[model samples]
Target: MPQINEKTWIIIAVVIALIGSLIYNIISAKKLKKKRQQFTRSIQSSYTHMKTIEDTNKKIYEISNEINELIREQKDTKGYIEKKKKEIEQIRQMIVTNDTILDCTISDKRDLATEKQIAFTYNIPTGLPEIQMEDVDKIRLFANLLDNAIEAAESVPAQDINGKNKRYIHISILNRGSNFFVTIENSKRTEISVTENQFHTTKLDAENHGRGVRIIRQIVAKYDGTVEFTDKGDTFEVAVML
Candidate 1:
């Protein structure tokens, strides 16, 4: 303030301008960083929302399939009441004729295969004690396997390319030293689809299907057993050891 020179005034002006510019740059950088952070949070929130929507859609799809199955079952109850009555009587008769629950289940499924024109043959060990399993498990395991086999065999043509009838299911049971080996083989028209070493159902009603194999696997796993699926082009075989 004591009579500054012109050159000193210009230098002071330049310094003030430099300081102002530096402060402006610092503020701009902070604002830009805040905006970038906000953008990142927005992207993360969008991704989370998208994933939530996807999961919700998956659950809705599962619920829809279950609803559809329940509706079909209700319709079936109305349409097949008479057939179910006949089947009940047949089941009673088969229960009277067969020795064990397993035998009855196999016989019932075999009769169904016969009606479908799919031959069923089973060679169960004679004089062997009933399979060491709970009655319900035995029925579930054998019934599910035979049901799937019969369904697949039914899809096979009445006569194969060789002009011979090969639509059949063959089941063999062996009493190993400490285990039971059961094998079910059936005719197939096309190659089976396998995913992650598991057989995928080829049935048109996919949602209502697929549960059978999963049930069978659960039963096998309950007994610490192993189930193997082998596809032989013209035939598919499922072998279980318990």
Candidate 2:
């Protein structure tokens, strides 16, 4: 074989160096691409996790609102229960003695009377009349009527300096001709109006509040009683006969 020349040897060395550099560049590029792919996947995963957290937060907010509404309703129910207990005690005493006077008065909140307010008076007969109704029925009738009156009164401005409208409630119970009659009257704000056979609410959102009248009507119907309402445009009156 012919001896290699120095110039040829130098050329061979240069070629080897170029091939090594090319191989190194290809390997580096592949490693960089792999790292970039991994980084993109990590970013996508973080985004997905963040979206999940946001969705969960939204659901929690909705649930909290519903819970708050339910709590308010429960508080109102508890207040009604307390009132009923006191009224029941009075009724029981009257039942035993065959005669008694029942009176109740509730104040409004903020002196605005734009909340549940109640006042009622009932005079039992000196002697139990024949065909006397059950104590439960009587209690139901009185409680429902009083509750409705309170709800109506709560809707109006307690003191209207501008005479916008004054809230008023008057409830009286009478026993006549073997039947019991109750009358409730209240003043309403001019802008608010309630129609018969439909629920009227003072709440900002009707869907959230206003079932007192509906429940009262149901109770009255159960006793073969009649409920009638008179809408005076600025005032309302309800009567029940049992």
Candidate 3:
């Protein structure tokens, strides 16, 4: 056999190096893509988790307000006091219970709203079923709805009744064939001032605050439901279909 020439050997070495470099590039590309995907998923999960926490804190704050009010109403009868005491405990149980929060839970939240002088009404069907969500999620969901409704309604004053402003919130649940609906409407004293129909939070620490409607959207996504908002000049309405 003829001895291989140095030129041929160099060419062979160069070709082998080129092949190895190509393989390395392909492997590195795959690793980089996998890492990118993992990072993206991590970011999404963290965002979802942070949003959930923020909303829960809001619910807790709401419950705290109710508790504070009960503690302040010291001029009521003993029977009334006992009744509120049980109500306080019941609301507290909702905070930690694993069972889903239902219309009755909504009624409790409405009571809190009424304490704020915001008239709230909810009409749930006699045969209505529990929403398909966890207890915490259900609370968060209604908390966001009722909370936002209260804020908007508080901003707007109802018919200057006796020279005083009134606030009102109306909520109703409906069963539409294969889906459930929650319709909430609040009185707005002024025209809707949102640009491009965007919802903005007035939270001072906005970086840590979660968007209420966005959080609702996330929860609604799990139910494969849809959320719709209609700002009707003097009324802001939200319809959640699940």
lDDT of 3: 0.68
Which scores greater on TM-score, model 1 or model 3?
1
Tens digit of lDDT per residue, candidate 3, span 1-242? 99999999999999999999999999999998976775565456445545644675686687677657767885545665575677555444332222224543565567687777787766766566656676556766877888778777767655485866567888888887878888999886554433444554454533322387678888888889888878777778888998
Model 3, residue 61: distance off in Å is 36
Q: Using Cα atoms with residue i matched to residue i, what is each candidate's TM-score against the true structure?
A: 0.56, 0.43, 0.52
TM-score of the candidate numbered 2? 0.43
Off by over 4 Å in 1: 1-99, 161-163
Whole-model lDDT per candidate: 0.74, 0.56, 0.68
List the candidate numbers ranked by lDDT, top first. Answer: 1, 3, 2
Candidate that beats the other on TM-score, 2 or 3, i.e. the better one: 3
**1 or 2, greater by lDDT:** 1
Give per-residue CA lDDT, model 2, range 1-242, as digits (tens).
99999999999999999999999999999998976775565456445545644665675576567558768777555664565567446434322123211211111111223333333333434453432444333434455555555555666655568745365666545677877776777666555565755655556655523555666677778778888877777777778786
Please give the range of 10 consecutive residues that has the lowest summed lDDT in model 1: 90-99
Clashing pairs in 1: none
| Model 3 residue 113 distance off true place after TM-score fit, in angstroms | 1.4
